[model samples]
Target: MTMQIRFEMPSDEALLLKDMAERFVADHYSLAQRSRMLAAPATELPAHWPRMADLGWLGAALPEACGGLGLSPQQVLPLIEVLGAGLVLEPVTPATLQCATVIARLLPEDRASDVLAPILAGQQIEVLVAGPDGMEPAVSARPVPGGWELSGTVRLVPGGAAAAAFWVAVDIDGAAVLRVPAAEAEVTAYRLLDGQAAASVCFDGVLCPPDACWTGARAALDAGAEMALFGALAETSGLVAALLRATLDHVKLREQFGRPIGRFQTVQHRLADMYICREEVRSMVQLAAEAMAGEASDKRRRLLSAAKVKTGDCARAVVRDAIQFHGGMGMTDELAVGHMVKRLLVLGQAGGTRAGHLTAFSAAS
Candidate 1:
């Protein structure tokens, strides 16, 4: 019999992680906490970082040799799911997993140890570039006395403002992925809606030794895209879950015409539909994660695109219904629904907009 993919409960270990994460969010981070953290100086997330490290979450996916638990992708999925439910913010979602996967798959063997070690150890913060929308390179890299000088623009780098370094792709003369130092490169930063920091980097006469150059730019980009898709799926899953819970809560006590609004057939049907959509989106995300873990490249790509399209549609629909169900209060920032909708909308378009993905899917087929 073929093994079925279970989208619901995870293993004991995953459950333990989930419980710990949920408790942490309850104790240390509510929506108020999120707002406070965002307003704080340095926007430093120190409290969260150490707690995550202590929980061994920082090293969840890396190999044992690199100070990680070496868990399979299946194991990591639950942890991310729990994070989604809690609406937690940490670099592990996109920055660590995506960057670490790129290093493991694309970087030279000699470089893997160097790159993954610090990340697993939680000593280094590496940011990945999403695209080149608003960035401009200052210096061009060319053969030098003993190394190379990199000059150019890398824009919309996630976590770039605080990154120790960046996994940058350069259109070297025409192409290459260059591992460059954030300290050496000048970067301008902007805040994302979800309170994450991103920046545009300008490289001005930055010196990169021969050791800094890595082959497999195209492969890394492809892998990065997949990683990003999964991250987005994970985040969307969180938003939908939050919406469901809030809507359920509102329905329970919200009275209309001498009965709870939830008692009405219409209200129940809307909620049931929302629940089904959320569950379906969850299944698609899980399938995409499985395909990625198996290294089924073509299958992974197709599944990721499919998940994005479906999830995007579902998110838009679910949030719209949620707002209508909750009435005007749902649209206010004080409530979680509005913020969740904003995030879902941004993420839906982040990796590749729905229209863009559809076009790509058509072209590929």
Candidate 2:
């Protein structure tokens, strides 16, 4: 059965993107392909960078002059969800679009075009900057002579070691986008629990020159948080789908007593509950994306926090139920469901834990 979620009715551009993503998944996300990539030393990204760039997806949130699709959030969420469904590991979503937006706004008009062009083209990788742990975008940087020196580490920096550059945050000093040179910065990279690349970026006085240092730390922080939340939600959605699909398949195939488990009333009820949880979380994510695309600053902040809380709740419960429904296999790595559970557990706290988001929402109100 086709699931009906609020985001099903996305903008025309978003619909076009959905079509592209559908084709990409059908062609590239076969079980064999995913298994092969998983067996590789690192999670696979494929050539999604250049190919997605050609589709104008890598730059969907940037300006036309900057080599972007210049698309809005309403036009981008569907694409992101498609990426999530496939569990693709490309660094394009937050690394490029989210980070590029801040750089475009903070950097000189002339320079933004140059800096953002490579990002859109998938030639350069940028990291989302944030700081002050327990808060959104937790990390801090400082300005030094000739350039800004990024201090404190952005733990679990996505593609941190692999990324060619970064946009880091530093306390009330505001946010500054630093073009961190790989050769110059010391990076410790590893695969995250979900098979995504993560690293601890240490800057022993890494210089972010004036031209290279972009401002507007607060605004950037907000945007980055929203991007991150969306990523978490998308990932959670994929996991939820996997859990529900597996449950449905199990009920139809497995037998209890003399009949199929699917005929069991209790089993049917459990599956229905699972579907409800998934749909509710999906709706929250769509509303969050739409709210982010809105113009009101206060409203946007409030909506994001609400979305985070709702997503966290539904995701946590869905995975737990999936575990219970699957019995012992749910906790084993031999089963892909376990990985989804772990990822959702992490997502619940990534952007901000439920309590943290609640407090932030309260304070904002």
Candidate 3:
């Protein structure tokens, strides 16, 4: 007798959104367009930002009360994966998922709507400065009668150059987060190896009103960090999948020893290994996404760290193998593999390095 295994599928809405994202990428995000986007001024996003807003992609993860579809992290995973496959250079992960989530969840109620509305509409960009330096209760804040003067530097802020504002963490008496206008800070912008924009923002006596600051933002920061980590995992999954497909295509087309290189037993074994790595990454991303939806913070952190470490490992292996299979051509900019490899390197270091996550996982246990 034969047995059948059944699994749950994504909702119709999720499937529709995934298909729309894939179609959007196929039509709008060609390699040339990606290059143009990278070369454009740091303050400008690609021309498609407004179009993405129109498609409700920008607001997909926000709560419905915040003018979004309120999609869960899991539901948004497929769309992120699609973006990854196309190597989309937009700051959707940093700006929307991480920064927006923090603002919506922790910002003062009176300030939330005004700040988030423009972001969801794609009219403004906000970046989070909550990495190690930003998280440290070290950014000095001095009382200046009605408001506080902030003086510190936040390094390696993703999407910082184009950001209209920043959710900056600071220390008054304890940990607090301040919403500071980008104009107030000295933003030194540069391109990451993956063609993404990053900046080091220095706030030398930047004044911030009391209303612009929120105290005890650690919980919110944790939530945003987890979301960012999940976004990286999702994108890495898509990148690995893309690399696998490209590798398979290359093996089938490249000739060696009077036949397709794919016919070689060793090549077939490598291809199989790549596929295995891709699936492992996908599974871990799904696990992390599911964990994020639950209320248990400890469990969520543990699982997210596990996912980050596994995804980084798999991404490294898959990219190395894909490049090897493609020979010298893989390292050239002419092919997508090299770009994907750079992105994998960036992603590995973005949320937290594999060693960092491993330590976190061990501590969590």
Largest TM-score belongs to which candidate? 3
Using Cα atoms with residue i matched to residue i, what is each candidate's TM-score against the true structure? 0.88, 0.87, 0.94
lDDT of 2 by residue, 1-365 (tens): 22222454777877888899879978886656766665664423335667877888777877676667777666677777777667666765557655677676566667878877776776757676554221243545555678666656666776564677766665535544556666667777777777666677777667667766555556655666566666667666666776788777767877769888779898788788889988887777777767766637676767778877877777777777778767776777666577667666656656656787789789998
Better of 2 and 3 by lDDT: 3
List the candidate 1 regions with Cα displacement exceeding 4 Å: 1-9, 41-46, 108-111, 130-142, 172-175
Deviation in Å, model 1, residue 344 alpha carbon: 1.8
Give the distance in Å from residue 52's predicted Cα in candidate 2 to where it truly belongs. 2.4
TM-score between model 1 and native: 0.88
Residue 312 error, candidate 2, Å: 1.1
Reference-based lDDT, residue 123, model 2? 71
lDDT of 3 by residue, 1-365 (tens): 21121223567888888999999888878788788787787767656777788899888888887777998888898899988878887788888888888887886655677788888888878988865522454357888988999888876888888889988877767777888899888999887899888888898889999988888888777777777778888899888999999999999999988999999999999899999999999888888887787648787888888998898888889988999999999979999889989988898877766787899899989
Q: What is residue 193's positional error in candidate 3, in angstroms? A: 0.9
Per residue, candidate 1 scores C-alpha lDDT tens digits across 1-365 of 23345554566877777688778878877789877776754324334765677788876766666566776666677777667656565677556667776666676565687787666666667766545211122235687887777766766666666677877666665445667877888878666776666677887688887778765466766666576668778778767877888898999889989999999999999999999988988787778777777745665677677888888888888888889988888878888777677767766667766777677666667
lDDT of 3 at 133: 22
For residue 190, give model 1's deviation from the true position in Å.
2.5
Find the number of clashing residue pairs for candidate 3. 0
